[model samples]
Target chain A: MRPAAPMSIKPQADAVQLVLAALIAFALALPFATLKPNRIVPGQPLFLLDGPPFWARALVILALIALATVTWLGCRPSLRIVVTATALMAVILALGSTAGHLPPSNAYARLSPAAGFWLLTGALGLGIADGFARLKPSPLAGLMAVLAAVLILAGLFSSGWLSGISILREYQGRSDVFWREAVQHVWLAIGSLAAAIIIGIPFGLLCHRRPRLKAVALNGLNIVQTIPSIALFGILIGPMAWIGSHVPGASALGIAGIGAAPAFVALLLYSLLPMVANTLSGLAAVPRDLIEAARGMGMTDRQRLWKVEVPLALPVLLAAVRIVLVQNIGLATVAALIGGGGFGVFVFQGLGQNAADLILLGALPTVGLAFVAAVIMDALIAWSAPRKGRGSIA
Target chain B: MTFASRAIPRLIGLCLLLGLFLQPQLFEPVFRPLANTSAPSIYAQAELWSLALSHVVLALGATLGALILAVSAAVVVTRSWGASFLPLSRSIANIGQTFPPVAVLALAVPALGFGDRPTFVALLIYGLLPIFETTLTGLTTLPAPVMEAARGSGMTEWQCLRTVELPLALPLIVAGFRLSLVIGLSTAAIGSTVAARTLGEVIIAGLQSNNLAFIVQGGLAVAGLAVLAHDALTALEIWARRRTRLAV
Candidate 1:
């Protein structure tokens, strides 16, 4: 053995590690809270050092150290994921406990986490998920990790571990109203989607049959989509109010200028473009050979449409449903401006009150709803895909 | 026949642009029936042209920002070294879409302290996903043979991307840009709520006072912009496709 062949090692730097390091550095340096006496009052800067207990602080430091160590060692992918996940959990617990323990200096005084805290938490959470994703390409794993974290967080919240947080206080005060608004929000979204499908599918089929109609219908819906949510809401009010007052039975059935009526109509109109366009596209995508074969088998136009076209089109159509549902859930937040009760009520109230926590209280749930809708729709599309097309469709 | 086919959409687009400028005079007669009602006439209150110009500017700015960010992101993810970042980039784009623009405004206001900044942020976020996704689709779905041929000719990665791939993908990318621009136009209207100068101010005021004319003015201006922009972009896409076909 001639003096052991010289070994050459190439130093490698992971971009992910570099990003995590920068994020940790930023979190350490920035002020974690803008301390305030109450929701309405302006907050003064409160650094991390001025807040969180020593152990909580230590946990944050430890997490950051662990992340750095993993980066330095260039650990195995699985080990990196586990370390990142643990660090994330530690950061979450530390932040939560810190927020929960912020002493209520007075009955009115409230301590709220500021921009830095939000940025740090979001970065840590995202980093951990990205790490998990790097370990395995599946989105489901990252999603499961997120679900686990959320469950743990929720458990903490419910068990009174996080009761002292300002946002929780906001929730505690309006828990009933929050639930009511959430229900109302979901109801409005579902109602508009149902209405859109009922009206849109027939219109789409009509457009599909008549090439001339397709252009006009599509252009009209596109124009409708171009109208801003607020403008659409505003436009609906005059006509709706006029109809409500002049039409005898309209008011009795809740068709008013304001409240849910205009909101529902606007949302329905918004949903139409996606529903109709998708229907048209999905139908168009059905293979010409398949349709011809169906016809050759003595299938009538109706049978071909029902049995062949729709079955083939189901995936795309379901995709459209997902898009419309998610879009409506988001758009419905603006409905609150017109007395259409929903999460927007909390949003506007928060805006008016100058309370960031209240806004988060409202906004987070809306995001949650949209996420749920997306996931469900994705699952539905996956389930509905033809067995032969599963590999191709995704 | 080709000229005629192309001319029709151009004509429609030009007509819409002309109509947008002439809306006050043209719509005055049409809105006369409502003038007698409690709501004020649309042209009576403010300069529709200025509001329309502001709306266009906001949308254009947001679209430019979104296009730059999205195209760069798309390009990065398609590269060999950055390929692993694709899912991450996609999720980031999805998150941008997942948060409502209104919520973005609310959250941004706290950090940026309300005005055009938050509005810009919201519009940029809202517009990003469409362009990014479409660009990705355009880049990723290039004909394998064409790509192989380009590489077979000893073209550098950047050169291939710049000369062949980009040209091929231009139409679809432009389509995505058009979608983002239209969305930005619509969404920028909500910027009014955050103290951003937009046509939405007209609409919001209308909502507050129950003024149909104001709503019509704002809505018409925004919608007209959208339709005209859409037509122009569609024409561009068609032209790009034709050019690519001719090149091939």
Candidate 2:
């Protein structure tokens, strides 16, 4: 008889094993989706076996079991990751197909993902995320994965398969409102960020020029930062309302207490810290010798700032833009509480009506938008960093 | 002079918050004019002290939970065998940043059910990233020679972690904790939408009734509490930093 080889299980497989086991348990224990009569109605859970055909049940379970076994038996990280990702895609496909099984005549009938569905998605996601962490791929690798997932989900949405999901039905009913609010959400986030940059950069420069000013300016900003964002928005309301009514033409310009104006101002205030801090740091990073060389070349301070200093500082400023953009995207949701239209309009409406699907209608997109913004900003920062690396050495 | 100046804002904040909680009527003189003629000048739907108490509970509880989970995760990922988790941790931190606390708090209703529970869960989830990232930095950035010396003295890895690494990292960890607590303080206010009895309840009630006084009261309480908490944490962080230096 051949001697069994010594056990040499890899360490990284431990987390994967746990994820797979949890995935299978969730699949077995809970329903994959709920068959709802309508958006607001609580529905019966469709256990994995009940929702999908025999083929899908077998495929999802079999894939998860195989991955679990392979990891337990020990395998290379890369092989495990590819198999995990493929398995993940398979599970997602299986989830979508479950919707197809629903009768078409039941117009308002929809599939709300139950615990089984979410738990399965979460477990598989952890596996793939674990893979990403372990693989240490290029910096853009994670962003690529995000884009790929978006593409796949987008494809699924466009195919009309997902229309049976409760959240989608909610979207179907208010598709136009959804898009408009999404655009408004983006506008609120970006508009405030733009306003902040215009005000913050020069303020940063002024502070950098005067030592005493930096202390006072940073202290004031710190105080602003410490204030709760919602409170700031609320406090601004009374004053802004007064201005709207008392100040001539303020209402014409949409400068009111409760609308986008106060939300915009509050967001801009929240955004200034990152903007000003980054600008200061970026400008401070400019090499003294380089500035002296610019001076020796007969370039005025303004010329040097606009030309040499600005180019080198571009990356840091872009970083600030990224932070502010992502942050404002999130804060803009709160604007809805104050009658400022954004994704939060759906979220708060959903809350008021106790409709989870409606809230998801608002939240899912806000999260997606913020993440996409982050990835794009990361790419820009990476792009800028390398090109400007040469200047730092000098 | 600098100390007194630095102390003033936090002191005033603490006093204001106390007055709001202990004697809501004291602010009546201030808020009366702001109130509409018919409506009351204070948030009367709930006990001001209890709401304040629950808000503290939510923030503190979430911060504690975050501290344990995040610190453990950081400790694990920094280990050689746990290296794979580093990227997962990084992405989580990144995603946490991308998602607003309000959206996160709202999303919890579906999965966790509404009320304070989901609110606590949301705050816990959101609070994790700051502490985790900061803990990772603290663990990784310790002076190399100090580590070498610890190993030279025959300290086991566990001993080194408990006795040396942790103490050195304490200040940074506290700073991270401070950040989480401050963010949680306000985020919990938003949790009022989900039935969490927070300072936000006051503001929401005010909004619903168009009571300017109630809104101002809630807004001031939350802001004051945040400033007070920020100062408290900053002091703790400085003390921890000083302790480590003194030991060395």
Per-candidate clashes, comma-separated? 1, 0
Against the unseen true structure, what C-alpha lDDT does each candidate score? 0.79, 0.85
Residue lDDT tens for model 2, B46-119: 99999999999999999999999999989998887887567777776866778888888888998888889999
**What DockQ class does candidate 2 belong to?**
medium
Instruction: Return model 1's CA RMSD, one decimal.
Output: 3.6
Q: Cα deviation of A211 in candidate 2 (Å)?
A: 1.7
What DockQ do you compute for every candidate structure? 0.54, 0.69
Look at candidate 1 and give me any clashing residue pairs: A37-A109
Output the number of the TM-score-best candidate.
Answer: 2
**lDDT at residue A67 of model 1 (Cα atoms):** 70
lDDT of 1 by residue, A219-240 (tens): 7888788777887887788789
Question: Model 1 segments beyond 4 Å from truth?
Answer: A1-13, A67-86, A100-105, A132-150, A292-306, A388-394, B1-29, B32-39, B43-46
Residue B37 error for model 2, in Å? 2.0
What TM-score does each model's chain B reach against the true chain B?
0.88, 0.95
Best by lDDT: 2
The estimated TM-scores of all candidates read 0.89, 0.93
